[model samples]
Target chain A: MGDRERRVVFVTVGTTCFDALVKAVDSEEVKQALLRKGYTDLLIQMGRGTYVPSKDSGKLNLQVDHFTFSPSIADYIREASLVISHAGSGSIFETLRLGKPLIVVVNEDLMDNHQSELAEELAERNHLFCSRPQTLQETVEAMDLDALQPYMPGEAKPVVALINKFLGFPV
Target chain B: MGLDAFAAACCAIPVLASLLAVRFAYVLCRSGLPPTRPRAAGLRCLIVLGSGGHTAEMMNIITELQKDRFTPRYYVAALTDSMSLQKAQVYEKSLIQGEGEKIIKNAQFMQIYRSREVGQSYITSIATTLLAVLHALWLIIRIRPQVIFCNGPGTCIPLCASAFLLKVLGLGWSSIFYIESIARVKKLSLSGLLLYKLRISDQFFVQWTQLQQKYPRAQYAGRLM
Candidate 1:
């Protein structure tokens, strides 16, 4: 237990995926699985309860936290080992720009399946890993930062120059 | 057939023939012209006249054109005075800053005369059309452009009418009307119907293949953007 390293998962669920994540965290099967895997903490957000420590366990080693709105989300992304988030375009773009591994959960019922479409497109382009509820864990585990490095659009120079030239500016 | 019916049919023949003649002339003129040469020398200007989502798309095209040889000018008219005008200005400045040449050198926010009730829509449209016609006439007189291009909805009606009047009055410039994407999606609007009545424009650029089959006067420019 002392040798186990600490890792944080940053999650931002706008509206639709909030309930699903809560359900996943509340399930006994998921909690037991995490416990078995030596995971020390669970950050449950959007008014969900914390992971209760066992009677004989030392200091309730696993802790779950919640956040309504925190300005420190950007700082969290810099510090976190992995990011699990909704498939919003802004979030996806920012995460990719920062060179971080992302596990995007698509909200099916919103905006004519735009999130799903965007996620699938990014996946096809090998930019990021995407999943629905059933395969979220697998998708998260499958996210290889090294493989994603090749796909990330490195610098903003090319796109910026293209836009500028289109606007009738000298390249 | 009765005498009145015979007389009516006689009147229809010339109308149909004249329509056919216009169609033939358009086809012949378009076919004879060469492909749009990228490096063709002249200050080629594309004037876009709409202020909405369509205008945003047009801005994208203008941006693309700025990268190329054509110089683009945007003339925006809309029912509301919201963020679209600001967006256009931003795009204009950004393009100028980046290119060191003004792609959208001239942009005007034309006023839209609004109507509250359904009945007033017609009156509103007529007044707006007349105002636009006068404005376009002045612009043509001042600028004396080589070609006037129109992407339709509200702005096309008056601009096309002004262009036709200029042509009829013996002005040497040519005009091209670009039918909007919505016309391809569904039936023509009231403005489109009115544009059909003009009858003297140099060319009609339509997206649909069926438009060419129905009205042979329309040149199939594929998609302008």
Candidate 2:
């Protein structure tokens, strides 16, 4: 726990990018609160998002590192103490796999409100917090890492079992 | 071997091997073997990856399955998907360092053109698919994975299809395990539907109960988030 105090707040919006999520993270209130909590660093993986903040997003006295798409986010996920991301399945599942405190920002503008379903489902399970661009500040302030549910392995057991059985292979 | 088995092997293996070298007929005559059974443990696996979520979900699978049991893993994805390649490389490295397991470094990046390309003619799409078929056949032949795992993605189709063909012919024994993406709640993706309808996938798993109930064939794995 002592070593974790220096970890970064990872904000990611997946491969295609969602400016909405990036904008939500670039708020004065969220930055001030995070600074007060002794978190001094922010890492954002913005993907192909078009909106770039002013020349510097480090105005709030927080060290910020931002990039467009990382080859592998595993290292970032591992280093993060808190993760704020778009409700892309890849980001959500990867964050959950590591049992990080995650705030999923659903891109509601998608064709079917598709991302909302997973975000809402995880929220309902108390696995992670779901936030919207409108509520980002408050949600960031209210996050409780220990309160989030830890992920369990084998959500694919029945399927894996059946595949092995059908193939007459053992697990 | 039984008389039928011997006769089929004699006629199938060499002919199919030779046909795979032919320009276009290779695509049409690829499936020339029977379904090879896998034992309880100690099997090589080829995990088909799509970019983004497909790769993420598969990496989770690699972390879950006992490493020693599923040895010499091979991950395949589209040639252009550097994200998938990078993630696979990281996962493979982590597995080796963390678990003290050795992984094969040569990954298979096949040229699987998307089935639904916007504004592209059907003929062009078919040509690309035929190309993908040969590439996948070469992969399946080389890796000869006892089981192939995939989450529903268009890129996964060609490899899974080629594996299905191997089962149809009598020369291969790779089992196709298709797991629907966690995002699918009500229905299967195009790849899932195709694999299910063709009855090629040995086991189909769905994350949501609603999806399982809708597709009687799909087994539910308690919500993989």
What CA RMSD would you report for each candidate? 11.7, 8.7
What do the candidate models score in CA lDDT, each in turn?
0.52, 0.73
DockQ of 1: 0.05
Mark the regions of model 2 whose C-alpha exceeds 4 Å error after superposition.
Answer: A1-9, A27-43, A55-65, A69-82, A97-100, A109-113, A132-165, A169-171, B1-44, B63-74, B86-127, B137-146, B166-173, B223-225
Kindly report which residue stretches of model 1 are placed more than 4 angstroms away from their true locations once superposed: A1-85, A88-91, A152-171, B1-70, B75-88, B95-105, B108-225
In the range A95-135, model 2's lDDT, one tens digit per residue, is 88898889998786676466687788778878899989878
Worst 10-residue stretch by lDDT in candidate 1 chain B?
B180-189
Clashing pairs in 1: A168-B99, A169-B98, A169-B99, A170-B99
In order, what DockQ does each candidate have? 0.05, 0.28
Span of ten consecutive residues with least summed lDDT in model 2 chain A: A153-162
B128 in model 1: Cα distance from truth in Å? 19
lDDT of 2: 0.73
Residue pairs in collision within model 2: A170-B40, B32-B169, B32-B170, B33-B169, B33-B170, B33-B171, B34-B169, B34-B170, B36-B173
For residue A89, give model 2's deviation from the true position in Å.
Answer: 2.8
